[model samples]
Target chain A: MFGLIGNIKAVPGQRDALLAILLENAGRMPGCLAYVVAEDTADAEGIWITEVWDSAASHKASLSIAAVRDAIDRAKPIIAGFGQFIETRPRGGHGLAAIAPA
Target chain B: MFGLIGNIKAVPGQRDALLAILLENAGRMPGCLAYVVAEDTADAEGIWITEVWDSAASHKASLSIAAVRDAIDRAKPIIAGFGQFIETRPRGGHGLAAIAPA
Candidate 1:
């Protein structure tokens, strides 16, 4: 499975607003197996998003979806900057709908 | 929910070995909602482990499990070093067994 783990830095005091948009947009996506949004305990303005998708193509396709695009637009202003973004190949784990074949 | 996202740098050419130990240890842990082990696309020696647990206490308790301790001891040799470790409070997302109360 395709995976992404990244940190998003929200403008000071806008973390909640940014988080709200993210959660609001976290709805039905065809290949999304897991989409977690969390508040970074160390950084007041930081948020972490961990995503697992069936394929890279599916992840890319989700970007074109209206709701996702809208969320991006709405979140742009408060998103101060991005931190480490790591693309990954998820092998398998608990809670995943399906595990990537070896 | 409590969450952890971090990078582990394996000794040169030991990534697969380290990965094997991790996967081997990924078994039934009471409050572990998700435990994903992934290969870092950009760094050959880097691995990412994203974990979501029912609570901070649950996460802490996991460290005492014999299997977990054994995995850590076995992985220590090949684990060259560590990178960013971020603690988080997960809200809700797809694929998680249960959502944290708002």
Candidate 2:
């Protein structure tokens, strides 16, 4: 499985707005197994997005989806910067669901 | 639960080595719900460490644990630097086990 953990830095005081936008379209992700948007407790302006996709290709394909693109466009102005973008191969965990064809 | 998504940059060519070290002592963490270590497919020297602890206090306490401390010290040299450090609140998803008391 393809796993992604990204650090998103929102403009000061705009974290909640960005999170709402992320959660709004999260369920629409076609091949996404788990797309979790979490608030960073320590950083008022930061959030952590953890996602699991069937494959790297599926994740890439998500970008082309109109809804995803729109969300990105909508979120762009509030985003201050991006921190780390890393990928991982997932073995298994408690909350992670079984992998299915995306 | 408390969620942490951290960007770890390993020195060039040390990604695998760093992963091995991380995995070796992962299971021993107390109060840990999920601890996933992933490689960055886009960056040769990057890794994403995603962790879920029972609570913020648990995560903070983990740092003082002997094993965790030792692991950190051992892995320090190979660590090139840190990128983004963020925290999050986990709701629920697949593969993630039920939250059990630590």
Candidate 1 accuracy as lDDT: 0.84
Report the CA-based lDDT of candidate 2 relative to the real structure: 0.75
Tell me the tens digit of each residue's lDDT in model 1 across B24-93.
7554777888788888988999899888899999888888989989989999999999997889998767
Interface RMSD of candidate number 2: 3.3
If you superpose only chain B onto the true chain B, what TM-score does each candidate give? 0.91, 0.90
Reference-based TM-score, model 1: 0.90
TM-score of chain B of 2: 0.90
**Cα-based lDDT for every prediction:** 0.84, 0.75
Top-TM-score candidate index:
1
lDDT of 1 by residue, A11-56 (tens): 9999999988888755477788878899999899999999899999
Q: In candidate 2, residue B49 scores what lDDT? A: 72
Q: Which regions in candidate 1 have their CA more than 4 angstroms from the true location?
A: A99-102, B99-102
